[model samples]
Target: MKRSFGLAFALFVCTFTFAQQALWGGTSIVSPEIHENNTVTFRLKAPKAVKVQVTGDFLPTQKIKTPFGDFDGPGAADLIEKDGTWEYTTPQPLKPELYSYTFLVDGLKMNDPNNVYMIRDVVSVTNVFIIGGGRADLYKVNKVPHGTVSRVWYNSPTLGMDRRLTVYTPAGYETSGKNYPVFYLLHGMGGDEEAWIALGRTAQILDNLIAQGKAKPMIVVMTNGNASQEAAPGESSLGFVSPNMQLPKTMEGSFEMAFPDVVKFIDKNYRTIKRKQARAIAGLSMGGFHSMHISKQFPDMFNYVGLFSAAIMPDNNVKSPVYADLEGKLKAQFAQNPALYWIAIGKTDFLYKANEDFRKLMDDKGYKYMYYETDEGHIWKNWRIYLTEFSPLLFK
Candidate 1:
């Protein structure tokens, strides 16, 4: 009996270890046999932490402030740490779906230690699961025509350095052997060429949009906006945004100078239609600022200009003569041609007023442009929606 008890205890330990490993290898966390409770609970163990906050893009942010209130015990309650674990319970039940979440420890980003669900590409991060609960149809990869992304090298005349750009070609471009319209997409400060394709999923979004007949089939070029070789400066070797590196005085030139060079290179290398209407330019955040600056400056080069949550009007604190020159560039485009200028902003975006105020300036100048206000704020989730909505109208 003693020997049998010892063997059973050892077996139990082995089984428990195997189960933990399986949970990470695509195994379900919740048992299907047990019906899911709509009132879900999240418990995170970070004994070293003093404060924790749960941030996610689930609904119109107006309701997010009081989200906990809509669920249970208290309305809009802050998650509290108990027994060295931070826990929050949903007032109601959650549907089956996966949600992206981040934890804030003393205002720093740290992944959830307790969550088992995770996805990895360049980085291994955690995600939450609410089984049978998601907008799976819209956020899914389908068996539709796909797009190809390539990393290319180029020389920047203004910065005096060779830089790299990532370009995406939609399906049929290779087999059809025909020139297609192009969209030059830009990234914001602290972001690099990989930001759009990786975080924004530009390729997937475009493929789905084109397949559904919501967007035109076109090529997208995502380029590094920084003129400096330091790239994102003080980030990791992968080069993400961090402290250090002052904003460029001649940001317009630092980024725009590379445009003509990239365009000339693409025309020489790829089967590209060399007409203005066949080309479009757009971006988000810093990228959006690029769209506003580059499109306005090179009106004869591109027909459509999209600014997604952009800082169109220059910041008042900017006193540099180089920064002031942007006004002259905008004036030139306004005087030349202002067709197809599309501006979109999330209602809760910090730049919401920036976009609205800039639109008013465009109106005063009689610029032909489109303005959009959606249910999101300054986040990748909203940018994904913008790409899906903006791409279909291009090259039309």
Candidate 2:
């Protein structure tokens, strides 16, 4: 009986160890392994899969056609099989940046089984890895003193609901007990309070920038730009409704009108500099549109304004005073002499023409503004870069 009990106990321990190994692809297997040369190797244990491929932002983009037009999208690389595992290594060293990828097993899309790091962008989820020794290092947590990121609830009388926001108080905020400036970072269409923190790496960027003395230590308030949704899907009482691209009130005037509620709530709650000179507003794509309209509608609210790949013109059919009087609002906004009115867009963005028209309109009006152009289209990579660049110029 003693011999049997001992054997059984040993067997159970071995089984448990094997289960743990199988769950995360034990010591023998690793999905994404970044090499010293900056090349990446991806491996998958797909003994049965006839074909497997890896797709990610690291690969060159291929032109994909959509209802709008052809646009560049992430391409796939085929993996070679050896024994029971499939593997592939990039031929060239990838640039030092954060990249997300997924495995395609026999034509089915799936996340990496071995690597657990991942983030959700509006509606899609993908595994992510960073190649450090460059700008991507800012996104990684280092030895610097990190700030406190809080999910705070605020009552929005204008919207008639309690909404959620992700706020980042710089390091030493609680201990120092001094009022700091605030930067309102909005999100693009289909994004929520968590978007900038997740996809844009807002917290990491601000933390690193502040530590390096490149940016002012300020509070960053990331709000749920979708006026109809109180928060990110599954975050509110919405009950796990899958996020989609067809979010309502994304660019409507409702969000712009209710923007002051967010500002007032932050000022009243946090130790904040309540004046316009200390306030900055910026966003990407749809969020950029909101920032532009919000700042113009209340020019005294933010002395610093940034439009990152902004949808310059409002939909002609959306009848609202916020979208009305295109030049009149700018005239009032500029007359106050805001510290900065900046615009930036990707060269190949579908909205490139619209941004150019916006620039032309500002030029014709003789408005003093700054413009920046990049190589990519309307994507998060550019948005992340924009945030890094824009934050340094704020409150300086």
Candidate 3:
């Protein structure tokens, strides 16, 4: 009886060990398999899931001319399950670009566990993959000199708190011992300092451009423009607040009032060109609004100003007392004789009319500015393109 019991226990141990190995070994299964033809295959091992679907920007709507007419809609197809695994493949080749995707398993959205490359945009998180070559190659880490990105904290007297900002120093910054021009890059509403680096691919773009001798080497500073918050969502001392709460009125002017403090801190801490000619400020959407107000308030602070899909308000629609004298302030700002006041927007953007009216205002005031129009609406695709074009024109 003792011999039989001992033999039984040994068999049990072996069975348990094999089961554990098999369970964990399945984790190596690759879900997103990028093919040489630029087509991608996504797989998910959710045997018990009732439904599964994959969606991404790469599955943009296509026009299909049916017997009745043409219909434009999503091209992505649902994943079919087989042998306890759901799989999907793109019907056609995708363009070379960074794309974000998510999987829906039985109506529950989830990230691709197999793909470790992920990014957060505002409230949503998604897995990402890159199709190499072409313009997307510019967004990839190439065999060129790279820049160092750092998250730096500084005191903000205007907001009466310490804040965090993302700074990108060029590759040779430590050894160059030369003062580099600075670019104050801001993100749209619902975005923070990380937006430019994550979604905009600023570091990769700068590295490629500088290496190609297309853009001048400069420091890019990305700041959190949400004034009520001391830092990005998770980093804020006030803690995470729901999206519905009304921000304090003081938050509206906090960044504008603290603009000087930011400049002073940068100049004192980093090796930067102290003159306005060596400085540039640009942003997208709400950030564009801040840039406009910041440059208007401190006319001599930045020589090159860019507004990408800017949220420009009409004179009467201006609510903040800080911009009460918009026209007069802008007139005075232009009088400072800055080098470039560039505005860019997509034709399909909802703010197109607003930008048009703002451009008309600039025209009426005889303020020299550059205007650029593109093909998309208010999206990150256009914003990235705008940055690619805008950065080359800066510090020239």
Per-residue lDDT for 142 in model 1?
74
Off by over 4 Å in 3: 1-25, 61-76, 238-251, 314-318
Q: Put down candidate 3 lDDT per residue, 1-396, tens digits, no spaces.
A: 999999999999999989997776647667789888988999998999999999777787455564422433234558999999899998898888888889988888898878878988777788988898877888899999999999999898877888899999988998999999999999887788889999999999999999999899999999988776677777777677543223343236667778788899999999999999999999998789888989998998999999999887523543666677889999889999989999999876777888999999999989999999997567677888888899999888
Order by lDDT, highest first: 2, 3, 1
Q: Best candidate, TM-score-wise?
A: 2
**RMSD of each predicted structure:** 7.0, 1.7, 5.7
How many times do residue backbones clash in model 3? 0
Question: Against the correct fold, how does model 2 do in TM-score?
Answer: 0.96
- Relative to the true structure, candidate 3 reaches a TM of 0.87
Which candidate number would show the highest lDDT if scored against the true structure?
2
Query: Comparing candidate 2 with candidate 3, which one achieves the higher TM-score?
Result: 2
| True-structure Cα RMSD, model 2 | 1.7
lDDT for 200 (candidate 3):
96
lDDT of each: 0.67, 0.90, 0.85
